[model samples]
Target: MVELQAATKLDAVFHALGDATRRHMLRDLAGGERSVGELAAPFEISLAAASKHIKALERAGLVRRTVAGRKHLCRLEARPLEGAHEWLGFYKQFWSGRLDILESLLRQEDAAKSQGEDHD
Candidate 1:
C-alpha cells in the first residue's frame, strides 16, 4: 500500500514535470521564491493559466505556495524530486555502462581497420 502510494506520487511528479512551462517555473523558483506574477512574466500566459500550472506543481510536491498580502509566492520544494532523480540515476548508470562498452567496441573496430589499411 505504501509502495502503491509512492508510485502514484511519482506519477504525479513526472506529470508535473512533463510540461515545459512548469519546468521553467521550477527553475525560476530554484533561484529563489517568486510571486506568481514574477513567474508569469517570462511568458505570455495569463495569471489564471500560470496558477493552474503552479497548482499542478503543488500537487506533485514540487513547489510550496505562501500567501503574502496580494501576492502568492512560490518556493521550490525539491525533496519530491529525489525519487525522480534516483530513478534517472539508475538509467544514467545503465546507459553509461552500455555506452562505454560501445565505445570500446568501436575503438577496437577502428584499430583493426587501421591495421588492415597498413597491410594494404
Candidate 2:
C-alpha cells in the first residue's frame, strides 16, 4: 500500500540520518554539490567507506549522485527529509505542550512556597 511504501521510505531516511558521516555529508551538500572525494575529505574514512555512506544517503533519497566522466557528483536531495521533519514536528509539539505544563507546575510550586514563607 501507499502508506507502507511511505513508511519504508521514512525508515530509510532515518537509517541514513542515523550515521554522523552521512549527516555531515548532507550538511556539506546543502552548501552545494560536491564530488565524493570532497565529501570524503573531511573524515578519516576511506573512499570505499565514504561511498557506502553516500549509497545509504542515496537510498534514503537524501542525496542524488550523478556520474560525470570519472567523478561522481553529489548534491542534496532534501524533499525526502520532509517526512522526517514532519514526523519530528509532531514530537516537538507534544514535548512543547508537556514542557508548558511542567513550567506551570513549577511556577505554582514556587508561588505556594512564597505564600507559605509569607505566613511564617
In model 2, which regions exceed 4 Å deviation? none
Task: Tell me the tens digit of each residue's lDDT in model 1 across 9-68.
Answer: 999999999999999999999999999999999999999999999999999999999997
> Where's the lowest-lDDT run of ten residues in candidate 2?
17-26
**What TM-score quantifies how close candidate 1 is to the native fold?**
0.95
Can you give the lDDT of residue 92 in candidate 1? Answer: 99
lDDT of 2 by residue, 71-120 (tens): 99999999999999999999999999999999999999999999999999
For model 1, name the residue pairs that clash: none
**TM-score for all models, in order of appearance:** 0.95, 0.97
